[model samples]
Target: MTDGQLQQLVSQISLHDFKRPFRHRAYFNARLRTTGGRYQLESHNIDINPKMLTDFDEKTLVGVIKHELCHYHLHLTQRGYQHRDADFKRLLAQVGGSRYAPTPKKQTRLAYRYTYQCQRCGLVYHRKRRLDTQRYTCGRCRGPIKPV
Candidate 1:
């Protein structure tokens, strides 16, 4: 969704769930890596990871928004806003917000192109490129190795 849509959603969620208005900005932040959303204490703005919408469902997106809203409301009211605080925990549970943000899945790539086995020790090694078996020996027992 666009930044304007995100702002509207956050505002709606805040009022509907928290019984308070979210007066600050809420926008997609591509730089957000690990966390699904962040509530800035200084600016009172909410930064949401755009990948959450692209990779997850609307339910997941709403959960993350609720989680950030918990922080926003609590902080604005001078209540416990940090995750470890009892007040934060209680309000988050009451609002049915997600306790933990979902981590993004990483793309996997094959790193090894070849495998070798030591003739004597049977130790195996994986390499991205071919190795000169004649010059190199097994690291464990100094035994000869052959490509497998």
Candidate 2:
């Protein structure tokens, strides 16, 4: 969704869930990596991770929005808004907001390319680079290692 849709949704969720209107901007921020959304205390604005929608689904998006709204509403009312605050916890649970954002799915990249096995012990080791079989020996049986 565009920034306009996000803003409208945030406002709607804020009013519907918290009974308060969100008067701040809510938009997707591509730079947000580790978080689904962030509520800036300074700007009172919300920055949502675009991946929340693209990589996941609208359900995940709504959950994140509710979570951030918890922060936004609590902070504005001068109540306990921090994660450790009881008010935050109570409001979040009351609204059924997600406690934590879902982890984004990442592309799997195999880092190890080469595999070495100890013939005697049947132990295996994976290495990103080729191993020097002539110099390395199996730790388990002190046997010669071979490329597998």
Candidate 3:
């Protein structure tokens, strides 16, 4: 959705759930990696991960919005707004907001540290860490494992 749409949704959710208005901006932030949304302490703006929409459904989106709104409204009202705060927890439960943002899929690639070949069957093996070739053997043909 567009930024305007996001702003509207946040406003609606704030009014509907919290009975308060969300005057600050809410926008999709592509730079957000893992968390579904974040409430800025200084700017008071809410940043939502664009990937949330692509990966999840409307219910999930609403939950995330409500979660951020909890932070927003509490902070504005001079209440406990942090996750560890009792006021934040109570408000979150009342609004049925998600406790924690869903984690995004990890994109880091792992490199193979060792390569082994079966002495008799010629089967290749890949591993993330070095393995003892003397102890481990090929499962298919019971052949000795040799470093390749």
- Which residues of candidate 2, in runs, are more than 4 Å off? 107-148
Q: 27 in model 2: Cα distance from truth in Å?
A: 0.4
Candidate 2: 10-residue stretch with minimal lDDT: 102-111
| C-alpha lDDT of residue 106 in model 3 | 66
Top candidate by TM-score: 1
Q: What is the TM-score of each candidate against the true structure?
A: 0.72, 0.71, 0.71
Off by over 4 Å in 1: 107-148
Q: How would you encode candidate 1's per-residue C-alpha lDDT over 31-145 as one tens digit per residue?
A: 9888899999999999999889988899989999999999999999999999999999999899999998789765577899899999999999999999999999999999999
- Identify the leading candidate in terms of lDDT: 1
Candidate 2: clashing pairs of residues: none
lDDT for each residue of candidate 3 in 1-148, tens digit (9 for 90 to 100): 8999999999999999899899889999999998999999999999999878888888888999999999999999999999999999999999999998777666677688788999898999999988888888899999899888
Would you list the rank order by lDDT, best first? 1, 2, 3
Error of 2 at 97 (Å): 0.6
Between prediction 1 and prediction 3, the one with superior lDDT is: 1
lDDT of 2 at 31: 88
